[model samples]
Target: MQLVTSVNSHSIAVMLLTVLALFLFTREKIPLETSSLFIIVALTVGFTIFPYEYENKELHSIDFFSGFGHEALIAVCALMIAGQGLVRTGALEPVGRVLSKLWASSPKLSLLLTLIVGATLSAFVNNVPIVILLLPILTAVSIKTKTSASKVLMPMGFATLIGGMSTTIGTSTNLLVVSVAVDMGMRDFGMFDFIFPVLIAGSFAIVYLWLVVPYFIKERRAPLMDTSPRVFTAKLMITEESASKDQALNELILKTDGMMKVLRIHRNSNDMYVLPNSKTIIKAEDMLVVEDTPENLKSYEKILDAVLYSSLGAVDEEHPLLEEEQQIAEVIISQGSKLNNTTLSQSRFLQRHNLIALALHRSGKKTETVLKDIAEISLKIGDVLLIQGKNEHILELKQSRELLVLDATSDLTHTKQAPIAFFIMFGIVAVAALGILPIAISATLGVFLMFLTSCINWKDASNALNTQVILIVVASLALGGALLKTGAASYIAHLFVLSMDGMSTTFMLSGLMLLMAIMTNVVSNNAAAVIGTPIAIGIAQQLNLDPEPFVLAVLFGANMSYATPMAYKTNLLVMTAGGYTFGDFLKVGIPLTFIMWITFSWLLPLLYNI
Candidate 1:
């Protein structure tokens, strides 16, 4: 319980304090990025306000902010931009489409297929990028197959974690560990050094998911077609005296309180699957299957003097009137967004964004009722909005950080650039794998090429950087460096060695892995790996043991983010989207964590001959 007083110690203490504060306050409440920014500011101020001497020199102020320029930060940003290019160019969509087709066979088969694909992709690519590419496709498939999103999202998250450990470049943590090891005079790891253990672990995880996941998971099937809460189908008939007589069906629906989806319109005994121009005059006895609720339908019924008709029919026509002024884009509302708890009319979403909320996809259910007022609607995390607006207007709305568009339909025309984008990404990976260039440099260059090729516009490139992730990574790196420079890592390692002096190597390695697994649940996987790697290496050196096994233990433990949602970003991304409570993560994640822990502990010694 010695007080830390040196400049480095104070900086480290302040950083730890900031992280602790964030852990206490934003554990399950605030966005991770906001918490990270808060900690960054705290560290900066802690270092500036309480100046302390380190090795007879005042701690350099620049060190506190230097992480923003770190190679890892640059690499991550570049990777995100490159990922955006791949997405915009539609390079990954074909793979996604094929995966979707395979998933159509059955839920069990779908889970296994997606697990394999996610793990394989993650092993080669960054997990975040892999998740970004797969999430939207999974959402679409869930809707199509009428499966609950909760069933697949966690599995995907775990798969990505396992897959990321398969290669040195798969995750920043692996690279960081490699760098630390080489700095400590150990042999540098090859790209495939960790692949065997990871593959073994991933195989066990996949089997565990297939056998045990279904039993613990509750089936959250969407209500049957009739009882579906959103997007109800109703028939409307136009009469001679109706206000909609001479107006286009689109205009009438637009002017109504409810946003209407016209499936089919019958006119003069001619069934037109395609609605005429929005200006097409409505004639008497015209029948239309429009999307509206009982109350809204009553109001429209009174206005059109239309009789109600009932039939289970599909609407195949796209109304020209609606097409001109209306557009559909999916928007995911972020936590603490200004639009939270606001209704559509009140927030003036229609007025400000020139968009209407046609439907809301929360968890797996779709609610189609138009917001009477948007500002009055409480916004929660992971609320997916199916917004209708003009094409230009929809793009404008997407620029706001409060929303993320799920489908980039507007960018589909750029699909022809897919091959070029793939080659750029492949080249970057090849250079890095071959050691011709550091991953950070190669990735940055790849991003530049993406921009030059117009795979992703510059504006989108900036957005794709994920500022929060960048800031968090930078802050954590700074903190890790401070820990090492201050001898905090050595101090802690010595303390651990003293406490476990008589323990055998097997127990020591297991303890280190378990400790890392626990630390990751509270701090972050990167932070855990960076802080733990040096101690693990130190422990191995102290015991005259190979550092590879010890470092591998840290890597394996870092990827076991199953015990808590805060351990990983993908967990939080699905929190609101899947309507999962914090407890839900623990309920499912804890068992999985234990499973991996036991499996790794038993398998590691055998694999590496520890």
Candidate 2:
């Protein structure tokens, strides 16, 4: 293969466009999806304006579009669907429950356990799936422990990255480096060949992320001050199978472990009311009203397997409250509305609009009254209603003049095939770990199983595809290809090595890793690894030194993509979820990347005896 010089007109234009794309991404003045599309257009036009020859083949516009269909991007999109399957079926909820118990006792212990789980699982499985699996569990832990999600989410992401550096199968970046080395006539790194060195570096990083990074990341999520978040009212029916079947009212309260309070009890036989005392024994057909969030309510409802009742009569299991498209929104009954002064049951609100009132907030109203009956809740001029409905009805509220929808959140429902979904997820990791199939093939298979098992429908699966992440990754790959094909990266690599010819061999190795580290943060890591491998071999041959240490340097430095969110996909995932800024990555990532470089520079020479 042949390469073109950067002095060519097309190469200079590509470099200029690369710098502008970086500005658009780092400044974040526009959405990533839009910026990425602009980059694609720039490359397409630039290549068209000035064609160049490389390896005796002329560069064409089709070459630019090829990035969109890269294998790495396809694998990531498939992993996201597998993640959605785990979340949809609530397959990991049991794991979350155990973590919740630990978090209730100690936040530090819970974080340690979470980090351990993340690092160990990421060693064998890909890092992306590890983060996806732990995301919801940590969220539940955060809610239960009353900790801000910002504190733990980054540590979780970093843990997986460090672990990925330990094994070839850990991440595609590591595997690509090994494959490139093998193609260059070097032996492939065995499974544990690099684990010891990586664990040495990872140990220090884990401590910094666990103990130090949290203090730097302040809680950014504002506490929910609006009453809507806390307005969900749950109606739990007492059954003969209930543990508190015949227990006294006070004993039932004592048995609940502060889960909920029994506002009132109703007789199931006829139209009647029962005011119970400490000695009052609960009956099998008793109704209990409690205030709880939808998540907590689901737990309690599942524990009892009892029925839920409303003033509209006994609510069936098919209600929107438990549907995948179920949503809760805060709506204000507007002025001059027919809903004013009329109860929900009287207005036939569910019948008219296919919506149900979960709770109502009337400020300055008396607090001691048992007003859990959403059906009897009367609407007022300024009263806020927490409404629950399917997507159709939730969107329908926007068209109604009588109410104003302030905010809304949709709930996801899982299928009964949770066990199958969980099995498929486990099988994907197991097959890949055993080297029976490539990760891309195993993951692609897992996605097919998700659809076959009914874990996710076709529409829902399509919605999981984030075109923004896909396009940005594609555009970056194209830019890296442009750099390599133009001989830009190779030129820089050789020029630096030539400039440092007078330095000691150790110093040259250090300078090489440092360059790879910087380049990895700018371009994709796979590109950096591919570009750096030949440079490492060339430098080692010039110095009459072993090529192994320099090759290892390229591998380690390429994985140190910590300086920017765009440098790594896992970082981007956490960035969006944590609501982080570019400054956030610079805050901790720069120091860590520096540490990794210094650590490798210091340790590699001692281990390889350069």
TM-score: which candidate is best? 1
| Model 1 lDDT at residue 552 | 87
lDDT of candidate 1 over 1-610, digit per residue (tens): 1222234456458446645743643364565667667766766686688776656777765686877777666776777678767656767666777776766667678778888888887766766656655665665566655567667777787788878888877877777677666655778777787787677767888887767875787644322211123334567877676767767766777776435556567775576554645656677768776755456666666666676654533222331112333445566654324455565656676678765565565553446445443335566555666565566786665433334454333121226778999899999889988988988899989888888887778776765666556766766666665565555655566667778988877888889999888877877777677667777876766666677888888988877887776677667665544546667778877877777778788778887787
> Each prediction's TM-score against the native?
0.73, 0.60
- RMSD values for the candidates in order, in angstroms, are 8.0, 15.3
Q: After superposition, how far is residue 599 of candidate 1 from its true place, in Å?
A: 2.6
For 226-259, candidate 2 gives per-residue lDDT tens digits of 2233334557788888776777777666655545
lDDT against the true structure, each candidate: 0.67, 0.67
Candidate 2 is scored at a TM of: 0.60
Task: Please list all clashing residue pairs in model 2, or write none if there are none.
Answer: none
